[model samples]
Target: MQRQSIPALTMALGSTIVLALLGGCTSVTPPAEPVDVVISGGTVYDGSGGEPYLGDVAMRGDRIVYVGPQRDLAARRTIDARGMIVAPGFIDPHTHAEVFLNSPDPEQRVNAAWLAQGVSTVMIGVDGGGSPDIAQAADRLETGGIGTNAVPFVGFGAVRSRVMGEEDRTPSGAELAAMKELVAQAMCDGGRGFSTGLFYAPQSFAETGEVIEIAREAAIRGGIYDTHQRDESSYSIGLLASVAEVIRIGRETGMPVHIAHIKALGVDVQGQAPAVIAMVEKARAQGIEVTADQYPWLASGTSLEASLLPPWALDGGNDALRLRLAQPDERARMKADMAENLRRRGGASAMLLTSPDLAWTGKTLAQMADLQGGNAVDTALAIIARSLEHGGGQTNVASFNMAHSDVDLFMRQPWVVTASDGSNGHPRMYATYPEKYDAYVLDRRTIDLGNFIRQSTGKVADIYGIEERGYLKSGYFADVLVFDPGGYAPRADYLNPRELATGVTALFVNGALAVENSNPTGTTAGRVLLRPAPANCQVRPR
Candidate 1:
């Protein structure tokens, strides 16, 4: 059949419509097409650092089909989100989430701790613990199922340990080459970046040049460099110097530098937030991309051994440490060192043991020391020895080291996004989002609600280059949240750290309703988010 001209087709169709109208035959109205879900009458934040607006956001399947003012679109389910905040689901850039994310039990894997905080996505394998075998890790996550999206990185600690095994020595030329290959391989296997906890040992032994060389692999492959800088206080190179090192890494490697849990930690660095912020801004102006994530809390949680012991003591693993603790001269040397370190972190009373299922869980170090009729250092060493003798686990403590003013200063920075740094037996894992909202947004008014939401959502995604998952926009993934203002607040504190946050009324992961009416629907709708591998290399199949 020949195609009709536009005028001819229009004339014929117009005549037919005219005849039908004349006969009153074009009278029946067609029904509105139903979309999968319509979220109506909410104060939408949109995650763009914009003012809140009353609007509706519509989702269909795994992507958003519409997001704007309502226009009578039909829907299978309409969520009346009146008086609630509709925003993109939060992205936690730094988290030790693998504790729950890698669990075999579906319930633990659901990650209710973060789920109730309105988080739809979490970056796992953080703090220099990310897997080099990212492909296999992703495969396991997808196969076993999860409730929140997970991204992976190739860790400096993991790679170095694989090559050196805590030898406290620089890598040989061949060893360094081997480590670089592992980084490149991991990047090709879809790692988003290279992460280092230079503050932690084994990795601490790696100097600036070593880090630059190792991280350069990730840089050339288009991945960022994330680090928990070598020191946040006057511990080693000093906080300011450590920050400079992070910047130097970026300037040299040509990769963006991200500081994890940026803070002015401990009594020694109590008022250094402004200086740290200035350093980051200066670096950014110099064309080195720098960003950081912070949890809204006063106390910083870390293992007691990490906080007190020297890296040299941790050189040959727990066995060597046990030997050191037993030697008279070595033990005396460690005691003096620990005492000085104790002074660096406030005093014994400033450290509260928080590791779960332990006899010393709730007491402050000072109290424990008093009970044992010993000095803080001796008491601490005793605990470490017992812990090592039994199972070689870390004696974790919450150091009340950060000043409120310092925390406030860091929180106000635009480049600093929100993260949980969520550790076991810590309230931050479950309540960081709500805590920020309740304490910073609602009470202190340190940041307005829209800025808070933007920092938690789109800002983080922008910093990390997350594809299509951090905005309530058309064609983006349907990772969204609806929460009641009155109900959304932190339920956990140091005294009761594992309590789940309250008031995420509706949560969607990839457009699936993972939580409805503030209850989980038992759906593991998460996916393994991977960056595209380098074009020169084929990604290892998972």
Candidate 2:
């Protein structure tokens, strides 16, 4: 113990030399020779926004090995895709399927609803409600065997709750460190990025600095930042400012940013679509990577409590809010504030209750209130009180808070991609893609079909950095959809929301038929996409 002395610089240099040598020799071995699955005689869009062409695609195991004339391909299985448009399976960039998977219903777990809509892959844990155990969840689903590939985001709310409990406050120094470590662990566990609903409780308490710090970790780890920004409604620190915050995060932290469910909500921000678009474009011009998703409808959905009550009333948790609602004077003030919130959102008539009791499912708030023999605000309060009493906090409600014209304006932007913000909300789960195709492509002709396909596929894949997906190249994932363009349309409406969309004939997930002849084959062939670190960042193929 006393005899040997090591030279500090010499040892350090020796270790560095050893690491450099190891790094220089590191290489990825090519996958073993793949099993071929051939798809023949199809009109392929390829998801690249390139023109549709007649060709055949050959798949080797889970990846596409060939996409050419299909003249000389031999395979164990051949799908006759003649007269169908074979393109990359749609990627839903924003979804809440993680919550559904936690449900007791088996149907909810697999999310066959999305599968029927030609969605082969989904990004789950959006809007501040995801989990750190996303890999375990994916494994559970894979082990249990479900349809569709799912990638998850580490949620801001979940991380905040873990670090700060249910209280609304800024993180203490140690808590901030804990939150950062949780985020890093989540990324290391296979999360694609971080998602925040800054408008929601717990997360709403987070200051911009805290968000930037956590997002910077994600960026360094090669993850994107997706946000449901602080506000989407009023011009006062709303749409423009919120969009600016996303851009600021991207610039400051060097993370690519995606604005979740980007919209100009409420009448105040109605005609401000162009201004918002200009803000995004300006940020892009300054070399900030920013993009957004829209749901193809004017109305948006959220918890009734969050939508109606002022942010202050929601400061603490459900218990504090219930106490305030019990006091007569506080109740009166809360009602007044809620009325103002309703007015800001358009009107009571504009609000539709998507989930109350099963009986109230399809009713508008005004109608439900009328049935309850009181004003809409009182009825909403009653529902909230009853839900609290029954241990059912925060019923889901849809506010007709968007301008159809504004939606059209946003959809026309080249950088704007399509998403459902998919959740229990009817349109998101049922009609998101087909509705966009029907509305923008077929009905109004605002955007051509090619652009629609591009927005749904390659554009989203490019934005989120999904590998070998969202395209039909010679060597890509064989996640493909075959649909009749003329027949494609969303069949679900607000009243009957759970209806499966029609017109997609077949879907292939990892070269295995997932949806066959308008039916789900119930195959779970999706792989968890663990993106490389920033130092080895792969530019997602265009």
Candidate 3:
């Protein structure tokens, strides 16, 4: 039988007595501490490559102060994150966002698309392209008010061009000394590392010995070596040899090495993921810290010239290449070389032209050829010539050169981190993280949620030695994200490359709200991250 409820006074007195007995005469427990922001009632993934747990996260100023069940914690602002996943904000280890960041337009400066994907930091000056004057570049980016935090890399190409021009020859003793000085100065000026697009001209002309010597400067100053290795296809040295070159650089320099956009690019190199992985594994076993990054898509974005022109053709520079193309004999030789290059790239049908100057921004090379009533090679040549004449620098192409199996294989490796390598005219620029999250983690189930987050967040931060970020832990920077796990996905695609993604509910960069309820707050709270001294670099023996 149900007993009548005790009187209000008796009930209150009984609870007080119970609490006192439980505490054994100790003072009453204090109320939870106050915080600046509290994200309550959510599943938390701490970015440690472990299972998520239900908990609360509290932040004050720019750092996380509490991460657990904090029912009594008081915050000036509370975000009810019920049924959502709360995790550390994603970090893009490789990106070209600096171009957009430097734009005078406020909308462009906000970097809203990437912010919506929960990216709080981007490592820029990648693929060997940033000002050699690191301090000046950092100052400009800082003054511009970017939305995502930025870290600068000193470009090997930029330095090489500065000292040697576009000529393809070994540097003289004085020139080599000058280049080394530039690298050291840039590192001192807050560059995170040395970045080289050795796959492209000028840098490609540099022998492996030269790269190792230049990278040594960064290594001594506490910087990693990040590279678009000399070749990813059967281009000159082949992908396997390029991987070995990267390992040699790391070994000689005594610094960590990172391969940008690691992949089995092109049909010639497809299905070689195992070989590539083995090389990297051997390097790691020898105590050299080696890692790589990849985007989710099968297609890789590059300028039309980069896709088809042999490194030798670009020896003198753009002007020289154009001059050569004008000569009938040189044009004939270039056409033959381009035919083989196109075949290695999986044929013209697989290459989609995304250049704005041409009328065929979304058409495949085959389609463009058909439209122009010409063969694929001739059509490609015509497009390049037109782009040079009146279009622009170089028309963009999305080369569908990767194998799905190879992409999956590389992605499963623990050392492989996620990166956008994102730039304008490609959907990857807007949708990289979400595509990986949705396609691989949710739909394909190739990777679990915790591992996916780890690859994109903590792993990247750890690899780059970014300070006080990439984890939801006490005393860490409060760059955080809250999103609907089931609904979070990318909306951008090839046809509509600029469409912003959907499903992020809230995002915070340095404790400032950048996005709320899937809408932008128009806040630019990003900071310029400097290279932490190499003492923190992870160097472990196998």
Candidate 4:
């Protein structure tokens, strides 16, 4: 014993075990297989809404090849993931990552903020804000270099803006056909589907029939329709009716419908989450596929003009709106309309100005108005005017319109997945996933860890028909994460809006280490994902 080395001791112990078991141990123990990377000794949440089990995950190239209990898996690189949670890297189904990834700045292209929170794939062109030129977009992202995988939606806003130039009227036959062609081409070129922000301008001008037709094009091409519904409150058709409209689109088009940032917003419809859930459930029962994504925030972020102005007022673009705001008769109508809109949004106190241009990034509309020596409406009008002068409609506001109860209720729905709807000025852009985990799973116990991972990863992938990703299944793409259980949290808040989140210990994108020790490895290993061409263009008959 004094002369025996550790290896000799181990060999003697193994021989004794083998002799005791009569070769049972030898028969059961498989030979070690070498892999590119091995993540060992972690509690694995498979991202299938199931219970977690202690296991090791091994990757070869860009694919996961093993997911089971402690295997003798030899690897080029091994991650000692003891006392950590190994999960599928989160898929952000809604994010404005394009705004940064496409920017000339290389620093923002890494998207370290999202990477630090364990996001491996980001869905862009959400809320009707993507390009119709899918091929060109893919080229742009590839040329610019991206940190997280990017999937795109052909934005309804872009499509309409291209063809109609913000016209308030219905498209002509030629324009409609042109729009449909653009959408079809986009789908064929790898666009996930047609994304419409009907709540915003231009797309808002399109009627139900127009949306149905446009959505049908994507549907026929095996694409899903993702929408920021026409109304989430009393802005136009109301929240309940907007839900019904989305259901109608799905039912009529025979396409899957996914509501982006689904919520019952404002004081007027604060408690309508149940109604929305009922509608989606009923549609699902009737053989319609309907799903939704929501960020874990009580307030919804949007432009000041988009949230308050009537769609008609935004017709003919910002120039026309500014002209109207200058006319006394027009201003009266706008004021009257905005007052009701503000009321629907739970009044001035419920809105927070989030634009960095103004000196009120974290202050409520009422407080900002008081400081500026005016009522909330006048203050808003002035800000919008000033924002227009800057040659871009970038007046962002964090509308504290949703109730916590409604948010919690929506979070409990099975069909509801997680998304950021992330934009520049909002905290949700950088903090959504971690915020959801910290507040909902860790702190509140509202949702368990397994289901949380499922909603944030697999469920989103499944809903979008994203193949070879999302779940931590063997043979799947190895987009994975390892994180400390106690250390997972978001650092980005409304005041420090652009700060990156913390707590992700490591993230692997396509078998490459993209984030290590809660920091980006400066590795731009992401690829652009595209939809496959549809087998048939046949849609259900009207």
Candidate 5:
């Protein structure tokens, strides 16, 4: 073969470079690559914690093929996203979306509340309520066709309760061993980690030492220790001590520690967010992995039982509590304790009924007491008694114990990402991202729009170790959304807590359009997200 002339070679190389650049402003699939969907001409927030840019995102199947300047690529669908903010679909680090995910109704299982809020993924099995049967749960989620992706954490309380019934005592050697085995099995079966609601009973019964021991199994299997903590208020060891306990747990186990819905709960702990932030930063500085999630709400929801009853009194579940309430002296003792708890939660007027009893759903505890012609304590006891008689879990309240200042302080922290400790009877279940964006980002400018998106998207995915789904980058999964900033705000409020949020123009889960024209397309494109199995993971024992 004859060698080409220098001018011919230079021209050929120049043409190749021009073609590469024309593929898109960034490295992308060739122009010949088929794009299933093209979201064009939008302000793109790539979830990189960076400034927004005007760009296009092309999707093919379940993956993003390109993200760059306007491309003249052919696509099956084209969305004119002009005047909208196009970003990675938000990832919620903590949520009780299980209520929807586990619903027998297919519509409920579609998880529209979260999908409407632009959430592509949610962490379920939160607050120590996860099942150890991770495989079974994953199978159900996949086969049932959910509306948003889910990550499951094997719960410490779930295993502990199964191994040892609801008792306020130390676990025997065999029981402890059994619980550890369950944690190992769950982790091996693809659970995220060991989660805890140590403030709740049976779980509360286990000492921190016991928890550290059980959580080590998760650590060994490369799982993070996610907790609702042992205390978030002046209950038990107090808030600061609780933070320290989590830090120590992380340090001791050599695992990451995530404080679920980290906050200064109750009057005694109000205005303590700064200190908590400092503690977490210090731990992080020490090379201990410590991250936290926070909801934007001033009120935290819980059952009357979880809020007012003492952990000891809650021992052995509602049956034991029923027996205790049946005894006059025991009832008197419980009332005294509950009265203090009510005060700690900022008085009876601050507790708003949220569910079950329609007649009293919107009333405060004080209002209910006044109408019932009884003191707050007596009214609370009566409600608890009635719930127990009806097989329990009938009462829930939104306790307005957090201060705006504290919430703001927590939100401003770099490590504190957005999450909804979402549950039934709370507006957060339907609208947390919009609420934060509307009130915190747009109104107060507490953090800029970029910060809000980062906190809600990449930051959460990074913290949870979810691979390849939080950013609109080349080769990432196509979990993307388009929203109108002017209209993306929460519809749900304290009084009307179930309304779906508005202003999501389009949402795609795994490259399938789940929402179009701000309406659900009724596509169940969600999957059970799983990380790579830990190298140390062992087969679960039979």
Candidate 6:
């Protein structure tokens, strides 16, 4: 200024005075020691496919600074982890936590149901139901304080619904453009990837070319494409062709493809697991980025409408579909198609109502039919008609459509990672991790403890490109779990679906204790994970 401005002069004087006081204070006081939290005397698995070893892990602030013998180290908190298995917290690759958040109970908020099982992170918005406002949802969860961290994948169904309702037709040029714009906006807003459910309404109408074009947009942004493929049971298009489509998209667009709930449903598809595995192996051999996730259970859960109705019958939303159901001519066509679909799904006797009328819970379609003195087909149609009348409410049903041999073969594959496919009606939400450990590792002895943990943690993290997490490494984010391996078990069953699992003792997120002594601290220390972000985005072992 012409003369130094008064405020600028005051700032200069203040800076000089502040610097002098800081110097005096620094000289007068000794430097404070580093803040470290230590976990002592435990078997460390580390999640790197390494042999387990006994050691102590030390954390400074939110990062792990040391992982070795702790005789000479000092810390503010020293946790005794004797007789416990210390590993990276489990990451559930597929979940429906977004729906649970719609409820108002704080205890039920963000699915603390998974926390006690040592799951610190969950991938939500799967099966074509993730939100476009992913960043805003993450902010809300963080502000509300969730018990576990969550990452969202933008759903094609939600995007399509926004662009064109549930109409059963191809998207026009303008509609397609609007869809692409919405996807781009979601990705820019921190969505990890794009997901689609081809078996569901609206999305079912999309041709392969449409899916490929949209997938390319996500690929450009370094996102993955996950799908509930069009068919998993029959050799019509077959599992091979379905998997091939996913691989082709990845190869063409340079994006990774993940197959959700990899399985061959129905007796005809039994023993076909090896062929599917070989196909995935060959794709990976050719340098296509491909992977898959599976829930341990043989039975799968979905809505009664999804599992039974022909795709065309569900083309429009509830109102239009109900109108079609009301016409006798339309009703006969739908009933015939429903009969064939039910048979293709292994019959109504194999289908159990997961979330029906309170009076019908645990009853099979066959049982309901018998009680009403009508055939199973009629009973099933009546249930769907009632649900449509209620404005398209969701009803859960379990399909006993998978084969045991197929389940074992998939579980043994080195590349097959574990996911819950967890949701409201499915017991996987409450029991996936522990159930896998108990069934595949303990009961079947198909995989060892080390291999199982690797599949659940490190392998999943690698597939999704999650950094620093899924391993116990120095200078990584301090997301850790301590559990009694011998004491671990799952308590929930289909009949008692809401019970919690047992044996995880402590869980830490970002150096803060989120779960202590099998109890949640009710703190939401989770962060939103965006694509192309560095590995330092998560808490890992030091």
What TM-score does each of the candidates earn? 0.93, 0.89, 0.92, 0.92, 0.94, 0.89
lDDT of 1 at 310: 80
CA lDDT of each prediction against the hidden true structure: 0.86, 0.78, 0.84, 0.85, 0.87, 0.77
Task: Give the Å error, residue 518, model 1.
Answer: 3.0
- True-structure lDDT of candidate 6: 0.77
Give the per-residue lDDT of model 4 (tens digit) for 1-542: 02234344224323432232232211223225789998987777778865566678899989998876777778999899876789999999999888778878887888887898899999999889889988888888988899999999999999999999988998999999999998988888888989999988888888999998888888888899999999998878989999999999999999999999989888778899888898899999999999999999988898889888887898899889989989999998998888888988888988888887567778888998999899888888888888889895568888887887888889999999999988878889888988998788755667766677899899999999899899988789999999876677788887778778877888999989999888889888888988766665322221
The runs of at least 3 residues in candidate 1 whose Cα sits more than 4 Å from the true structure, single-residue gaps closed, are 1-32
Please write out the lDDT profile of model 2 over residues 1-542, one tens digit for every residue: 11112233123223432333233221223224544666777766667775565667777877787775545555777778775667889999987766555556655656677877898888888888777665576567676655678878999999888778767677789999988888887776667999999988888788898999988778888889999998898623777888888889999999889998889899878889899899999999999888898889877988888888777777767888888999999999999988988888888788888873466788888898889899989988988888888785578877888877888888999888888887675566778998887777666767776777888899999998898899987578889898866566787887777788887888888888888766777666665565554543333221
Cα lDDT tens digits, model 5, 1-542, are 22234344224323432343334234455457678999998878789876566678999999998888877879999999876789999999889899889888899888999999999999988788899999888988899889999999999888888988888888989988999988888889888888999888888988889999999998988888899998999988999999999999999999999999988999898988889888989999999999998999999988888899988787888789899998999988999999999989999999999984467898999999999999999999988888777778658799999999998888898888999988888899988999998788756668777788899899888888899989999899999999987677788999899898998999999999998766778899999986567777765432
Over 1-542, each residue of candidate 3 has an lDDT whose tens digit, in order, gives: 12122243223223432332233221223236788988987777778875555567888998888876536678899899876778999999889897678889977888887898888898889988867787777777778788989889999999999999888999999999999988887887778999999988889899999988888888988898999988899988999998999999999999999999999889898999999999999999999999999999999999888899878888888788889988999999998999999999999999998865459999999999999899998998888888778733878888899988999999999999999998777889889988987777755667766678899899999999998899988889999999876667788888777778777889999999998877778898988898754553332211
Residue 314 deviation, candidate 1, in Å? 0.7
Better of 2 and 4 by TM-score: 4
Q: Candidate 6, 444: how far from true, in Å?
A: 0.2
Q: Pick the candidate with the highest TM-score.
A: 5
Ranking the candidates on lDDT from highest down gives 5, 1, 4, 3, 2, 6
Candidate 6 regions with alpha-carbon error over 4 angstroms: 1-36, 70-72, 532-542
TM-score of structure candidate 3: 0.92
10 residues in a row with least lDDT, candidate 6: 22-31
